[model samples]
Target: MLILWTQGDTNGIGSEVILKSFHRWRHRPHRAVVVGSYCMMKFYEKRLNLTTPLVEIESLNDIPMQEKTPDEPLYVLSLSCNIKANVGEIQADAGELSMKAVERAATLCLSGEADAMVTAPIHKEAIAKAGYPFQGHTDFLEHLSQSGRAQMLLCDIETNLKVALATVHIPLGKVSETLRASGLRPHLTALANALTKNFGIQTPRLAVLGLNPHASDNGVIGKEETEFLQPELALLKQDFCVDGLFAADGFFGAKRYKEFDAVLALYHDQGLIPFKMLAFETGVNMTTGLPIVRTSPDHGTAFDIAGKGIANEASFLSATHLAIQVAERRRHLETTA
Candidate 1:
């Protein structure tokens, strides 16, 4: 079974994308179980007018090992929070439900009941206001798994480009310090391994981006690029197809980015700005180095237009598809080896 945990409140587009992805992909052999409030889901079903039925399951054992008939392709393990969410409005109750959904998803993934997990966008401010110490979904999941570091990779299969960030969710002032040798190599290694093992990229070509303007103009603008990044790149190239310290400005040019399989960004915006520009609606945010596979949409919770019923689900749908593909690939490698 593939358990998909959605951050709560059906009033938002999360509910819309959850049902949309399930409806579109339910023909697969695996069953998708939603971990969220039953009432919230039902509200979404009525609002979106989707015909799919959501079943409430007590446990993973309640699901049949195999479907006797081919008609039922999906199931929902509805864990009800029973909270009323005001459409397009942020509230404490909604925040609580979102956190619960995240917690449930992490626990299920850890327990081996779910093959892979896909998370919907959650309101970070709402979550923090509710007293959760999480920086975001990736940080929360990494903390839950007790993993060393979680590498964030944005992939667009159409272009065969996978961009991973060395520093995420941090202020710009700290980006240079964060790009030091102790910080960069581990994530580079993690992304390289994930590409080979899960995505079947045998020799992944990696391009590392420069931190400052024009890669610090060869150390005239900043010395961190030459001091920290160049050394790390040299060490990484020993084991992988790692190349860069390329100037961030020119790296995203049409010719340069297409030359490599993946581009390593120094900071969040340094990479995401170009990434979004290229594949805003088609990208997938995949977390590497996790014990269990996890992916989310490249976008975040659009609180400004939360419940207007106009949020696009393209990124979320792409993320779901990527998670399933990676999970199936991992399963295949395990079975064959």
Candidate 2:
């Protein structure tokens, strides 16, 4: 398997975490390449005093066509841009380079040049400053892949806790209207298919978190649960083994997430707040419903500790492992089919 990792932001801890994760993995079973500026990677390697050998390749075709060893040098498919790294600062040039890396990685994956992609943390504000209209990687990748719909799935490898968001990177004020307009059936169907195809769950048992406080307290607080959610869930039961509209607080507090194969949260924070609290170091964010495999560390660009050599790579490692697992599973299913 070959994985293409995108250099998130030259000004953030993206380079630090990528270098550290590769260094820590002594016995490599797969080939990995970084898609970004070679100069930026070299700068981090020297500044952090790491011994990982960096090799710059002209294109994806230049990658060595053989099994990689435990001590294999990291290959970088350097982009055309020449952005300088300014640690702990947000620069438009850095943002432009990071997004360019992402775009190239997506193209490689869709073209079958790469098996999977693992993205580093990218700053939302920086990308905006760069004049891109994307809110985050999920939407940007969706546009690149031209997928029907993209959903964000956060997973914890240690505990097998997986949560998928129905609505992502949207304002809280528009969540209700968006849900009503788009409907929940498509998101639920997509989540179920992703579990079966990506994670290899034969018959996934799923749960959903409510959009209202206390699940609307039986319509005492809000009508979303009774008016919209319940009706959709009732109709969806015939096609899926899903139960939900559970109050977010009690469901997670009581450890009910373990009972289901995966939980679907209506909005972003409804799922991420609890997920980050439980698996801050091990969380892996994956984009489902895309034609190609994609995963990233759940955390963001830590500018405060960008150049301090203290950023943890646990989550990035987890994301790498998950990407490999999913890619292999998809390949297996393809061959069998």
Candidate 3:
């Protein structure tokens, strides 16, 4: 598979991790082409004291149609942008370059010119200043492809853990008022299909977390579980193997997630805190329910260690491998159909 990779914010450690990662995976099984500014990559490669051979190409068609050998070099589909960024300073030009790379790479995936895409960590505040009002890659890719639905799936394979958020990018105070059965039913349904298709589970077991404290503690603390969550779970039970209404706190504390294929949380932090805690450097953030495959490192752009050459590339490399597996599985599924 030919993977289209986009470097994220230059101010952060996105480029550093991307360079450090593929260099480590010198014997990569598949071909990948980086789709960001060439100058930025040159700077990071030099700063990180790396000598990964990269060939600059004008387009994906420019790559020779042949399997890359173990000793072969990687390709870089460098966007013709001369963006220069300070190591730890947010630069608008860096934001724009990353945004442009993302848009172009996603378009290639949508056009069937590329098999999949693995994006680097992007700085939300910097990208917003670049004039794209996206919350993150999930939102931008969903909009870019005009996808009907998008779900964020955070997975840690070593831990055998997966969590899908029902709501994302909203304030803590607005979570309760924003959730609804109408919206949640489809999200959960889509997530179930993802677990089955992507994870290859014949019967995917799922758990849904309650929104309130102690899952509302029989109405002592709250009733969203009684009035809202329970009803939705009942409706979802007909189509899913969901055993839900678990309190968020105790569920993770007791490690109940081990029994389920995936956990559906009502909001972001309710799911991510435990995920990050267990797989801080290894989690893979995947966007499900799109026609094309997309994945990213679970962590964000660490500005503190942007240019210190101390960034870990485990998550980024994991994301790339996952994208290849998903794309290949999807192709086989389609061909056999």
Candidate 4:
């Protein structure tokens, strides 16, 4: 249950959310550690007036392999980033710091030093400026884990909603072509696998949303559903209980989303906008089809609210809880299998 929490951008609310999360817990519930700048955490501790048992360690070897105490405190990996402690402004150094922390933490998970990972939000612009040019945490994780075809799954336990995106962090103009070129099979496969394994759904049924209005009205609006999706749907139906390139707005508006185990949205905004609308402060972002378990808060860096001591930690806390559950389930499944 050694969860490594990566400190995201120093310019945003990553550190604050993390600290605030620990503060909200009456008693520590998970064995978690941080993999980020020690100085930055200290600065936030002062600014946010939050305190936790922070055991700063140079490496994983410093930790004892035993059950953690209820008040075991949050251990930090303690990498020096020379953080400026500047809140609410993006910087190249903060970007580098965030990337370094994530890469190091992911390395631990890949190497079996950690059981699961909960990443704080990282700024795409800052990370790009720092020379780690990737779309976001998901892409960076794909590279680090060498896990091909990573899928982004967002969930809200309270709302009982799960959305898996086909294409993330891409322009709206390119979404159609991207989904068309990639085909729906991979997205379908990944979503189905995660639902079965992580969520323990024996026969998960999924709702597939269209890339066009009215699901293209049988090719009147767009051919993506007929030309690309139909063929794959024909093949996937043999193994999965999936149906529809349902029209997005109507499906969500009618609350048909609740009828399925999950929904597949063709693009980032398509999936996230509705998901966030329903569960803005409680959703968790999970990456499936990876060698290691990874989950994150649904929100971004939140620079506008950084250092205000008012950023909600519920989403980040939910992410941590889900990571622990998924990790345990994964281990149990491996043993049982």
Winner by TM-score: 2
Q: Considering summed lDDT, which 10 consecutive residues are worst modelled in model 3?
A: 179-188
User: lDDT per residue, candidate 1, 1-337, as tens digits?
Assistant: 4657565544457887777777666676666677777777777777767766777676777777765334663455666656786776767667767877777888888887788888887777677877888878889889989988788999986666688988889889877666663556787788888888778889988888888888887789889877777776787788888887888777777458888878888889988988888888888889988888898888776666765557777887787778889988888998999
In candidate 1, list every pair of residues with a backbone clash.
none
Query: How would you encode candidate 2's per-residue C-alpha lDDT over 66-96 as one tens digit per residue?
Result: 7788878899999954677789998888888
What is each predicted model's overall lDDT from 0 to 1? 0.77, 0.92, 0.86, 0.88
lDDT tens digits, residue span 3-73, model 3: 98888887888888888877777687787789887777888888788777777888888888777777666
Best by lDDT: 2
What does the lDDT come to for candidate 2? 0.92
- Stretches of candidate 4 off by over 4 Å are 64-66
State the displacement of the C-alpha of residue 282, model 3, in Å, after optimal TM-score superposition: 1.4
Candidate 1 regions with alpha-carbon error over 4 angstroms: 8-11, 68-74
lDDT of 4 at 253: 93
Which candidate, 1 or 3, has the higher lDDT? Answer: 3
Off by over 4 Å in 2: none
User: Clashes in each model (backbone N, CA, C under 3 Å)?
Assistant: 0, 0, 0, 0
